[model samples]
Target: MLVNTFLPLPEFITGNILWLAKKGFAITLFLIGTDLSLKVIKTVGIKSVLFGVILWAFISILSFIVITVF
Candidate 1:
């Protein structure tokens, strides 16, 4: 069940990257805005941000391993 929830992540990421590439500077600005927002949120006592970052790192590493292995 948990694995199923994340099954579409790679596809989602690929689509997002393609969309970003197509949009060029606009997408870059959006991503930068999101980063700034996240930083502000973290500064405002959002402790879960660290956990989210760790989770993202773990999932990214797992995805890399799966891709390399196959």
Candidate 2:
């Protein structure tokens, strides 16, 4: 954001570059999912995963309510 303060940047800077950078970022994030393996899932166990999902859902709902109200 700070760098973009220099906006309406010169013609040398184009949307194509930004588009390519965005795609690169998305591809990198997608590749990160490959690190999760079945062994890790088995190690953590389904019960633990269920508990985590429940906790996450609860927190998300609370946050949504709080943010919406205030």
TM-score of 2: 0.49
**Pairs with steric clashes in candidate 2:** none
Tens digit of per-residue lDDT, candidate 1, span 5-57? 77655777777776876799775696586675756766755566667668989
List ranges where model 1 is wrong by over 4 Å.
1-35, 38-44
lDDT of 2 by residue, 1-70 (tens): 3455776665446566778889988856754764645576589898876797699799999999999999
Cα lDDT over the full model 1:
0.73
> In model 2, where do residues sit more than 4 Å from their true spots?
1-35
Native-to-model Cα distance after best TM-score fit, residue 34 in candidate 1, in Å: 2.3
